[model samples]
Target: MSVTTTTPETTSTTQPKKRRLRTPYFQVVASLAWKDLRAEARGREMVNAMLLFSIMAVLIFSFALELDRQAQEATVGGVLWVTIAFAGTLGLGRSLAAEKDKGSLDALLLAPVERSALFYGKMIGNFLFTLAVGFLLVFLLTVLFNVNLFRPVLWLIIVLGCLGFATTGTLVASMSVHARAREMLLPILLLPVILPVIISATRASTALITELKTEDWLPWIQLLGVVDFVFLLAGFFLFDFIVEE
Candidate 1:
């Protein structure tokens, strides 16, 4: 039996498989944005401050201008956009500064995600915050200004304006966060860059509110769309360099 025994050859069937490294861009972006939203929601500090400031700004405008029916209808666009811009800036500054201060920004950078993902994440988060503030401002302004801001066109303007503002603001904030006076630097850097957006948004919104011809407002809307596209693309491309520095 021992002489007749044959040795069975064993073949190795187990081999280590190589994993293809996937860039978790969308996942990273969504996670980071969600984290910021959760933090902001839990604290409520940024939203509360923005809301209070917007209210105060509206009150000041109401009392300062004594906007009668005609004046209110005429200036509502400027008033609403100005209030939203200021309040939104406050939120953006706080959001980025908190991340920089907490060292979470570094951790985020260290993650195996594309830098553009981080930029989009921050921009989306800021956009949501500003959009909320803008919506609140629209509602309050409509009541105070006695203008019908609930129009669909006005909502579209708000969406476009918010997208433009957030795209530019996030990029500027990334640079300003590293500066010595980040709080001051952020607005200085951001406001100048986003002036085109503000002006175009205000004009487009005004046209919509006043029931002007679409042709008259089309240019402004186009300008806003162009500005948003440029900034969004620029931010996406420049984010990696900005973070590295």
Candidate 2:
């Protein structure tokens, strides 16, 4: 009996599945930015320092010069921008230094994510922080300078100003964080490059406050928009190189 049972060929139903790869770009960026915010919230050091510095700036401006309503009106733009700029520097310096000191920067670099996202995340976080400081300054300055800083036009100027400031500040902070004299180096390196933004923003803000022709304010606002776009795009391209080093 040739019991040659023809064994049916077994069809293999299992196959190796392709794995989906996650880049972690958004996740890493959000976590990194959130880390900074959470740390600042817990300590309250950065916000407190900025508030104190802004208040002091307002006080100094109030007493620095004798000014009636016209003079104060003319000078309001300068005072508000200067206060925000100085306080912004303080916050930027502290935020970057904290990351560097804690080795979080290195870890973030090692994370498998596109570097541009990191820049955007940091910039957005800084923008929010600086915007808070700016709003507070506007309120305090309105009282101190006796000027109506809450105007819709003035608010628009503030938005443009904050955008410009945050974009440049984030990029500069990336570079300055790695330097030996990072704390001191940031302002020197940052201020020169961002002067155009400050000048345009200040001028626009002043024009808006004084009810000048829209043509006068329009040019400055346009200039501010250009600067913001330039810095933002430049930072996006350059962040990868900065982080690699």
* Top-scoring candidate (TM-score): 1
| Model 2 lDDT tens row, 44-66 | 88888888999998998898967
User: Positional deviation of 126 in candidate 1, in angstroms?
Assistant: 0.6
Candidate topping lDDT: 1
**lDDT over C-alpha atoms for residue 20 of model 1:** 60
Q: Which parts of model 2 have CA positions greater than 4 angstroms off?
A: 1-20
Model 2 poorest 10 in a row by lDDT: 20-29
Instruction: Name the runs in model 1 displaced over 4 angstroms.
Output: 1-23
Q: Judge candidate 1 at residue 134 and give its lDDT.
A: 90
lDDT of 2 at 173: 89
- Give the TM-score (vs. native) of candidate 1: 0.90
* Candidate 1 lDDT tens digits, 47-134: 8998899999999997798856866777999998888788988988887789888998888788777889889998999999899989
How well does each candidate superpose onto the true structure, as a TM-score? 0.90, 0.89
Provide the lDDT at 182 for model 2: 90
